[model samples]
Target: MAGLTLSQASRALGKSKSTLNRAIKTGRLSATRNEDGTFSINPAELYRAFPEPSRNTLPERPKEPDRTTVPDDLGSRISLLQQLLEREREAVADLKEDRDRWRQQATSLLANQEAAPAAPPLVKRHRWWPF
Candidate 1:
């Protein structure tokens, strides 16, 4: 009556009710049956049967990485990225210039072709055959 009930004992011991019930039934843990048919286990006996888990044996969680601190190579990485962007811009400019030069050469060639006179047809040479 003054001791922990089955549920309370199981919760405090971090074990299931069935486990404690089995322990009590198997005589590994001693408990008094109350008039209401619920088991009342003594804290001393429960601790003796299943000792409290030691906190020291658990591994400590690693501390979270600090986001505010800047890395040592930040400046170098930014400079390298800037240099790459500049190189890409220069390459694009060169490609545009080459494209314009090619377009100009093609238009000139077409103009020259149109300006040349057309050759006369061979109708006179074939006229003797008659229609």
Candidate 2:
């Protein structure tokens, strides 16, 4: 006879493996052990043991809000982000300009120092000692 494994029987009957095992142990349902020591239950025997529940008998769950709806404050958030980005860009440009001006001033000062002449060494005259 055709049969279903314990896992298949559990899925069909909406019951757990342990529950079905208990039922078999209590002699409520019949199953045969396979060569691999696994139980195979006949589908007819399973239904005879536990009838399927009626459809639409379960309570309906509360519905969640749809994800497709756009948030009301999205436009304002985008504008705020854009303003922040512009401020950051302006600050970076100002920093770059200041850095260039300082670099030019340093270069000019170095060049002028190099072009200037070196000071002459001081000459020292030693007076002869009269004996």
Candidate 3:
């Protein structure tokens, strides 16, 4: 069994590197690192991860295909998404409010700093201990 680098495996497997990484992360593919800190992959493992059928090994299925109909949960999903988006919008508004508050506080601090008089510098004391 020939081992391939992650890039080589992706090219040979016709999959992107991110796809391969996701495969490894999801336990779909097994990978190992080379001594050079590069990934070494088994082609067999890649194949097992994303198997391809040769022309001769193609499955024979019925010509008729089932029609795809949207599930009833789709409406609820859309509504949930809408609600999530509204929540996100509210969060953004809250963040903006917080940012404005912080900005005002920062401006006040800067103004106060400008209003305060400068203090005289303290003289440095010599240390006797040598640690």
Candidate 4:
């Protein structure tokens, strides 16, 4: 009556009742077998074998927004997205300008380059020593 039941222990530990029952049967955890054939687990004993789960283990649920603030929230989000889009467009325009400037420089350098004169052909000479 004082201690936690198997189901209660399972819920607190974020595990199944069958798991706790198995632990008790396998001597991994200690529990009392009640007259009604239910387990009466001591909080200390249960925790000693299986520590309570940390708060970080549970997933966080998002809070629902107020109905009246929904429209304002949407407006703010849209404005922020628009600002980001404008910044991205400006960056792309700057990159395009740089690319155009580089292309013009390359074409000008190629056009101004002078061709080198061709070398004269060499005549073959006969060697006197065969070795």
> Per-residue CA lDDT of candidate 4, range 17-113, in tens?
8899889999999998899999899998988899767633444335567633345456677899999999999999999999999999998887766
TM-score of each: 0.41, 0.41, 0.42, 0.40
For residue 27, model 1's alpha carbon misses the true position, in angstroms, by 0.5
lDDT for each residue of candidate 3 in 1-131, tens digit (9 for 90 to 100):
66888788788767789998888888778888778987788877878877864622434334446844444465577799999999999999999999999999999999999999988899888889865
* Residue clash pairs of candidate 1: none
Error of 1 at 116 (Å): 99
* Candidate 4 lDDT trough over 10 residues, lowest sum: 55-64
**What TM-score does prediction 3 earn?**
0.42
Range of the 10 consecutive residues with the lowest summed lDDT in candidate 1: 55-64
What would the C-alpha RMSD of candidate 3 be, to one decimal place?
Answer: 11.9
Better of 1 and 4 by TM-score: 1
Please give, for residues 1-131, the per-residue lDDT of candidate 2 as tens digits.
77999999999988999999999999999999999998999988998888876632343334447744334466467789999999999999999999999999999999999999987888877669754
**Candidate 4 stretches greater than 4 Å from native:** 55-131
- Candidate 1 TM-score to native: 0.41
Candidate 4: TM-score? 0.40
Report how far off residue 44 is in candidate 4 (Å).
Answer: 0.6
Model 1: per-residue lDDT, tens digit, 1-131? Answer: 37999999999978999999999999999999999999999999998888887732334344448744434466567789999999999999999999999999999999998998887775745566578
